[model samples]
Target: MPPTPIRASLLLAALLLTSPAWSADPVHKEKVELTAEAPTHSVKGKIKGYGTAEYTLTGKAGQTLRVQLKTNQPSNYFNLRQAGKDEALFIGSSGGNSYQAKLPADGEYTVQVYLMRNAARRNAAASYSLDIGLRN
Candidate 1:
């Protein structure tokens, strides 16, 4: 059955309000670069088949970063892991839709967005905005 007009309107409104960080399909989660010209990065996508959508932020040692995610679905959380490492550094998860940290080295850092305690059901559509930037 088709969604009602009011319901469709609300859905459209939500999608329109979401920032354009949602990446196209086949997102490369490890190739994010933040520059002086473009100091923030945002990606929007979904989690299918229990896998996470990955993103990377590059910065120098001692740089403070605040990364946040805004989502339209439930059970969406992100993990922050150091680059080239398998385990999440400091065992940290976003706890909700936000992550913050001070980088320990000058290199790449990984931010992984996932669903429901590390598992995503099939065809579950999740839209999210990732905001990564330096702390003021």
Candidate 2:
């Protein structure tokens, strides 16, 4: 027997509803590196502006992520964010630049660098580099 219009529609709808057309958030476990240059020094040899660097990270819903950073100069700082919340992950002065943190959840996150405006007297420029890594 031929199916009625309503019956055919119902069958099609049921088939589509039961089909697998959904996916969960992807788990990303990787490392990202970033770098920035310091602003030019003032005539009196004072650092004027702060340089910045940024990175985005993604991971599973409940996976732990680690971030590491290293710099060449002093008075440098870093900030980490996950799920839109920001935190000052690291701050250093006159030493090697390195920092680490754990991921909040399975989503996109960002890390930023800020060069402290009071590093030295002469306005000089310097190159800065950052290294980031992740783990399960």
Candidate 3:
């Protein structure tokens, strides 16, 4: 069957986005040396403007992942993302300071520390401490 115009456009856009020519950044840019069973439980960084501290953690499907963020400023928060994925797996920004989720895939995942939306929009810099725990 012939593809619809919108479907063809969407496919073309997806291909262009994933093409090696695009040169996209990895979701976990910091690349922490993390193991599934022995996860790194602590990290700290400062985020300014659109900058985020992305930490990579390796884990198996069904493992429980716990993340917590703390900062003197109320605008700092954290989020979780699977490697290569564009959307967040778990978001802690709108709620409090922590998030825990049962992982859905086996791979290197990201723990992103970022400022709140308004803070980020203002290009403010905030210091933060994050703790990540993974358990099968």
Best model per TM-score:
3
How does residue 74 of candidate 2 score in lDDT? 56
Computed on alpha carbons, the lDDT of every model, listed in order, comes to 0.71, 0.48, 0.76
Tens digit of per-residue lDDT, candidate 2, span 28-124: 2233432224211111111124435555655555444444444455565556656555544344433235544455466766655555666523433
Model 3 segments more than 4 A misplaced: 1-28, 84-86
TM-score result, candidate 1:
0.66
Error of 3 at 124 (Å): 1.7
lDDT of 3 by residue, 39-68 (tens): 756766777766678888788899888888
Stretches of candidate 1 above 4 Å error? 1-30, 90-94, 117-119
Q: Which lDDT value does model 2 have at 128?
A: 53
Candidate 1, run of 10 with poorest lDDT: 21-30
TM-score of each model, in listed order: 0.66, 0.48, 0.68
User: Which sequence of candidate numbers ranks them by TM-score, best first?
Assistant: 3, 1, 2
